[model samples]
Target: MDGDKSLFAWVVENYKDGHLICDDQSGETADFLHISASSRTLSFIHVKKSGSSSEQRKISASAHEVVIGQAVKNLIWMDFTALRTRLESPPIEEPACWNSGVKGSDRSAFLAAFDRRDATSRTEIIIVQPHVREAHYKHLHENGLDHEQISEDTLRLHLLEGLLNAARSTTTSVGADLFIIGSSD
Candidate 1:
């Protein structure tokens, strides 16, 4: 994640077309959904990002903590500085995360709900993106890169970006959200 926005492409590539479900009962390890409907469409669940203190506590205690790259070490072996440079310099068509000022929080509960194997498989991706801090955006502006022209999706993209940008060896596991896909397999 390097805290940069340009590195989001990789995250998107990795996550798209994958199965998403919540672990309502903490049953089986989550798996890919290679069945009908074939991901007909996707939507966002945007939540107002304020009073972050409670939000932080909620996510930290979430049943599943998506661990990336063998461990949290994914934060390491990263060129965050270089990533930042590219994000501000190119002023790519895609907006950088710095604009929204939303911090990354866990999306486990949303998935945990999917882990359930009952009649009501209710729950959808709630694109809860937080706003980026003003300071990060200020730093980008001072870099001589004019990103003021671009829009802001700083929050939703954080998770997607992280998934896309993660190294191949990196694995994102929602152990707490695992439930059997079918009656058997």
Candidate 2:
């Protein structure tokens, strides 16, 4: 994908079995809200892109901050009641989210799943950004303590990791999972 919009489309398409109840790429709501009946899980997906494809190999603290902020700020909408309200009556006219693949029957079934969901049902906040490379994040997760101040990029990576950790902690407290979809490079 070239950017966040494309990434959002790809994610929604790839999630074959789930119902994409929300697809608000205009910043008015979550980028994507999905529910999987069989998995009994709901997901809030937020997408962010680096400055350029070349930047994908580098960790951008600013990018992470913006994406994570979006994810954390929208946590209040995780409630089933709030989602139902949005589903029934969108805040704007001709909302793109409401015109998605979800049908009336699908919404009803998903709503039933939401209502009957217990402690076993799971929720997730996903931050999809190509700014942070997977290997770099893993290295920081593993040998971060040993490396003293290496470079500006390293410092930025550390800051990004810290932000991710804090966001994860906040989501965990609310009984949701937090994770990053960083670059494979």
Model 1 over residues 1-185: C-alpha lDDT tens digits? 44443213322323344322211112211111111123332212112222343322221111112322222232221232442233233322332221112221333322332233333332222222233333443443464245554334333334434453442223223111111110010
Off by over 4 Å in 2: 1-5, 25-29, 92-113, 139-149
TM-score per candidate, in order? 0.19, 0.78
Q: Which ten residues in a row have the lowest lDDT in candidate 2?
A: 97-106
Model 2 score (lDDT): 0.70
| Candidate 1 deviant stretches above 4 angstroms | 1-21, 25-168, 171-185
Q: Against the correct fold, how does model 2 do in TM-score?
A: 0.78
lDDT of 2 by residue, 31-104 (tens): 87667757867778888876667634666778888888888988887676776676666555544332134333
lDDT of each: 0.27, 0.70
